[model samples]
Target: MAQLLKMENITKKFGEVTALNKISIELEAGEILSLCGENGSGKSTLMKVLCGIYPYGTYSGDIYFSNEKLTANHIKDTEDKGIAIIHQELALVKTMSVLENMFLGNEITQSVITDDNEMYLRCQTLLKQVQLDVDPHTIVGELGLGQQQLVEIAKALSKQVRLLILDEPTASLTEKETGILLNLIKDLKAHNIACIYISHKLNEVKAISDKICVIRDGEHIGTRRAEGMSEDDIITMMVGREITSLYPHEPHEIKGEVLRAENITAWHPVNTHIKRVDNASFSLHQGEILGIAGLVGSGRTELAQCLFGSYQGKSAGNIFMHGNPVKIKNCAQAIENKIVMVPEDRKKHGIIPIMGVGKNITLASLRQYCFSKQVINEPLEETIIHQSIAKLKVKTSSPELAIGRLSGGNQQKAILAKCLLLEPQVLILDEPTRGIDVGAKYEIYKLINQLAQEGMAIIVISSELPEVLGISDRVLVMHQGKIKADLINNNLTQEQVMEAALKE
Candidate 1:
């Protein structure tokens, strides 16, 4: 295989912080290179540099495409060279139709005029190639996260991209959708289109990659054939140490019920008849982690919101704190009752982008740590924030940094630390480790174990079957706003959970 692109001596810095440290990388024609690294380890930075987001003077590097030194002045320059990037978050206008999104900037024309028919036909064929069954005329926004993702890929493909850059593409996708995307990636390779697969999902990386390159602390660790590398070896290279086991579990025996929900049902703010959450009833016990496993659009998130009193409009639910039933109408009421929740979509709900780390960490618990009769104690607040950051092992230069500036894993840790600050009797974590790296995931599990050991009831909702089975004392599989299976999860496997999840 001939070399397609090479980035030599890439070094990037932001003020006093160095993002990339003279990292060099090479890509071959039709190759699928998996870029493995921790969050903030410069995987995304290098990809951005390749795509010209950093521009010429912003960094020191030399890029060669097809043996010709390439100039990456802007995104258009990169795209002009048959390179396209599909980001971690899908960028598509929801109001527009699939065909429109596919040929957004580069539209089709016939007889020197814009041709909608030709573009529509091409969009249909592309959708078929991607195996997405949605109609080309359908609105992109109305589609689920998984479907929207397929549309994003279709849009990128329409650009005639040769080297496709995918960043955490499966972060929001379900098992079935992830499989579809993985297959699409394989199809791209067959078409002689090389791909740069960047993700925190080691399992998917091992499954789809032809070769893997390890990057740690902004430096190139090395590259090896995917077949020859073990997950342990890759993890060690990325984090600079061996992480033998990913899941860190603690034995917790439930002593008493900490939270109880009965006949919980909620409707959409506009669509009342649309049952977002059905008559769901569940319980969380002290010193136990109860995991909720379900696919996207299965009402798992809605249920968590309803319980947290974050749901708008009429929500009929009987929430009990330690067997004592109480009514929750807002976030304040829920917090007062010692019930706290971290939402599923961190970008959409969890972290405030403009808010500083210390402020976001203390957002939930501000009421409790008040000093001098309702006036917030700045000194005490600082002390708490520092303690939380250290206790969580959050990798940040200072607590004053914006929460958005941190890596996905570190942002998640900040959110977890916020929940801990609330000191809730029950913790509702929805997709707690979603889009985060493996090392961060183990830390989250450790945090959960520590909380449970101290008699805190933890309810975890996740799409990963192995994660649910590994962390929870009992697994509650939800399907279509209803509990499908409530298993003890002792000696349970991913196959068993999937069997139960798919069970009618």
Candidate 2:
């Protein structure tokens, strides 16, 4: 195999902070290289440099493509050199057709007249190459997340890409969808196209990559053959220490019921007739962790939303606090009733991106920091923000930094800090560790245990059965908006939870 690309002495800095050190890497045709690191470990930064998102003059790096000196001033320049990147957030316009998105910018033009027929034919071929059996004219918004991901890949293929960069591609994909994507990458490899795969999932990394490169804090740790590294080894390299256990579960006493939902039913936001959550009844006890386990769209999230009073659609249920029924028609009402939730989509619902981390942490409890109707106690607010950040161990250079600039794990921690500021009796976490790294996951799990120990009733919702089983004192399995089973998590297995979820 010929050398496809080389990045030598890559170094990037922001202000006085060095984001990427003198890091270097190489890739050959048809080879798959997986970049392993904790969140904010410079994987995305390196890719941005390669794709010219940082541009040539901004970063000190020598890129060689096809044995030629490659200096791209922008993404378009890199795309012309057969380089493409698929971001974690799918870039396709949801309302447009697959064919339109495929040839969005690089359309096949016939004398400046739009050639839909030619684009349609090429789009079909590209979809075929990716083994996606979807019509080119199909609306992208109508497709599932997995299918949308494939469309993004098919769109990349249409660009005649020789090298592809996938960033957290499977973060939002289902298990089956992820399998299809992994197989698709292998198929791409067979076509002699090189790939740079970046993900927090070590299992997938080991299964797919020809070699694995680990980086930490802007420095290259090492690059080794994927077959030679275990998940633990990769983790150790990435975090600079061996994580013997992924779940740091601690003993916490379970007490009497703190919150209960009886006959809960939630309607779809748009389709009023469609019930997203149906007659879901459950109880959460103080000093106990309750895990909701279900497949995507199984209504676990809807149930949490209903509990938090954030469900967009109408919901009917009897929520009791200490056996007294309480009315919670809105998020403010829920918060006032001592029930708060850390939302599933952190970026969308949890944090204010442009706001400072301190401001985001204090956003929910700002009233407590106000001295009067016209004034805010800035010193008091600052003190509380610092305390919350420290308590959550939210890694940030300063509380004034924009929360969006932080890593996924740090952002999640900041959100947790925000929720903790409210001092709610019953706390709900939806997909709390979805996109975080293993090290960060352990910390979150530990924090959950601590919260439970402090006599806080907690409800956790997760798609990963291992996570649900690992942390929950009790597990509730839901299927198609219905609670199928409530089982104690004593020596529970994934098979048992999955079986309950699929059971009629």
Candidate 3:
């Protein structure tokens, strides 16, 4: 294998924001390089520069490929050079068939017309190379998140991509799915196709990457070989400091059952046999953190959705608050019942990107400050917004700022504040500290500890095994839409829980 791509002294700026500052990296043939950074820390800008989205002269950089200095004038020119980026948001069209999505914009056609059969056959061959086991004709939207991820890999495989870039490839995948994806990456490297994987999941980086590059505040810290480094060491390198503790899970003695899910079952929107959730029942205690661990499609997110009344229709479940049952049909009813859920897909369900921080924070709690005529009160809304911003430690210019303008960590904090506005007895955080920096993660952990200390029954569903192990009093492992094992903290290890998660 040879040095396939080299980026030298990459410097990019967007108005007042310097997205990248003198960043440099290399991607060798048949090896994976992982870029580690917080959300706003220059990784995307560097990638854009390479892929020609930033173009030449827009950024101060030189991209060399195949031993030639190249100027990528546009996205097409970059693709023509055999470089492809699989975005954090998987760029698969949901309603389209797998083959259609794979062949989109570059469909296989006969000398006379479009040849879909040829396309299907090609898609099948490519999908198998990536170890996907679904029909090429299957609609991508019908598949689970993990399956959709496989489809994304297949789509990338359609082209002769020499340097494939993937961002947060396993953010929504289960542990099993993540394993499969990592294997696929290894396979790609075996073919001498270099890869650049960007993620905040340090464990995955340690497992798959040959070298790890740390970027902070839009500057390259350094790149180190991944062969010898502890998780703490990587965290220190990425954040340029030692975090004595990743999570301050100070045990708060449980008082009583504050929230309970009794006989919960959520059906799939189309297929019925594979119930998204199957007879799932769990209880959250006051002043304690409950962790739900599962493979992808184990119904963790579905169960949270069902509890929050965000499920499609006819969810068979009963939620009890302080031992009294309640029916929550929608988000409003769930808020009325003092049950708040921070969804796993934060960008899709949790935060409003275009809305201001103040408005988004006060979105779910306007009833508490309604005027005499039942209209939302402006002064009261401002007061609540400021209080939430301060309480959550959200750093921004002001509450009037757009939520997207903040870092991923601060935006997560904003969502935490929004949930707190309802004074929820039970707080459901689904992958809450994802895609953020370690310092931000510790701050969030401290906040969760404080919430637990305040007697708030908290249910945390995360894909990171270490995080779940660190924070939970009790861990529930789910497989195939059922709770496989509910184990106490003292009785669990990463291996044991992973074994339970892989149960047949």
Candidate 4:
């Protein structure tokens, strides 16, 4: 195999933060190179530089394609050089048809008029190449996430892409969709196209990658053959130390029931005729971590939202606190009743991007620092904010810094701090460690155990089965908007949980 691309001595910095330092890597034709790193370890930054999102003069690096030095001033420049990147966040106009989106900026034209027929034919060919069975005339918004992902790849293929870059392509996809996408990548490789793959899922990386490159704290650690490297070995390299255990489980005493939900049902937000959650009932004991496991769209999130009074749909449920029925009409009522929820989409719902970390942390419990008719006591707020930041170990230069400047882990911790300020009796954490690194996940697991030890009833909704089993005292599996099984987590296997999820 011949070398297709090479990046040497790459150093990228943002203000005082060195995002990447002297990183070097190479990819061969038809090879799949997987980039493994912790959150904020510069995996995306390196790719941005490669795809010219950072441009040539903005970073110190030498990029070569086919043994010739290359410089790309814009994303189009790289695209013109047969390099295409598909971001984790798919960039497609929802209202546009699939054929239109495929030839968005790179349109086919006959003289002065746009050639819709030609573009449609090309789009059909590209879609077939990616094994997507959707019609080209279908609107992008009507397609599922997996189909939309395939459309993104078909769009990239339209550019005559020689080097394809995929960042967490399967992060939001179903297992069947993931298999289809991986198989498509194999087909692309057979056609002599190289790929640079980045993902937090080690299993997918191990299965698809020929070479694995590890980076830690903005520095290149090493690259090794994917065949011999175990997931633990990759984690060791990415975190700079061997993590003896992925889950730091600490046992705590379980007390009497703290929260009880009976006969809960929720209607779909848009489609009022359809139920998203169906008469789900569960109990959480004091000092116990209850894990909710389900497939995507299995109503786990809907059930959590209904319980927290944040679901944007009609719901009927009886919630009990200490065996007393309580009415939670909205999130404010839920919070006032000593219940708080850390929502699943942290970036969208959990934090204020432009606000300082302190303000975001205190947003939920502003009344604690209020005095004399809604006037906030600045001194008291500052004291509490500093204490919470230190307690959560949020890695930021100062509390006054923008919350968005922190890594995903720190942002999540800040949200956790926000919820903690409310001093809630029941804490609902939905996908708490979705995009966080392994080290950060361990820390979060530790924090959850500590909270349980402190007698706080915690309900964790997660897609990762390992995390559900590793941290929960009891596991509740849901399938098709209903609770399938609720089992104690002692010696429970993922196979059992998955079986419950698939069982009718």
Per-model RMSD to reference: 2.2, 1.4, 2.8, 1.4
Q: Higher-TM-score candidate among 1 and 2?
A: 2
Extract clashing residue pairs from model 3.
174-296
TM-score for each predicted model, relative to the true structure: 0.94, 0.97, 0.90, 0.97
Clashing pairs in 1: none
lDDT of 2 by residue, 1-504 (tens): 999999999999999999999999999999999998989889999999999899998999799999999889999999999999999989999999999999998889999998989988999898998888999999999999899999999988888899999999999899989999999999999999999999998889999999999999999999999998899899899889888888878888999999999999999989899999999999989999999998888999999988888988899989999999999888999999999999989999999899999999999988999999668999999999989988999999899999999989999999999989899999999989988887798899999999999999999998888888888999999999999999999999999988998988
Tens digits of per-residue lDDT for model 3, 274-354? 688889888888888999998667888889989889988457978898899988889888888888999877888888998
Over the stretch 384-405, how does candidate 1's per-residue lDDT look in tens digits? 9999999999988888899898
- Candidate 4's C-alpha lDDT? 0.93
* Model 2 TM-score (2 dp): 0.97
TM-score of 4: 0.97
Which stretches of model 1 miss by more than 4 angstroms? 109-113, 267-274, 312-317, 369-374
List where candidate 3 sits over 4 angstroms from the true fold. Answer: 108-121, 264-282, 316-318, 325-327, 404-407, 479-486, 498-504
Model 1 residue 130 CA deviation (Å) reads 2.3
The runs of at least 3 residues in candidate 4 whose Cα sits more than 4 Å from the true structure, single-residue gaps closed, are none
Prediction-by-prediction clash tally = 0, 0, 1, 0
lDDT of 4 by residue, 1-504 (tens): 999999999999999889899999999999999999988899999999999999999999899988888898999999998999999889999999999999999999999799989998999999999999989999999999899999999999999999999998987788889999999999999999999999888999999999999999899999999999999999999888898888888878999998999999999888888888999999999999999998988999999988888999899979999999999989999998889999988989999989999999999888889896579999999999999999998888888899988888999999999999999999999999977777888889999999999999999998888889989999999998899999999889999999999987
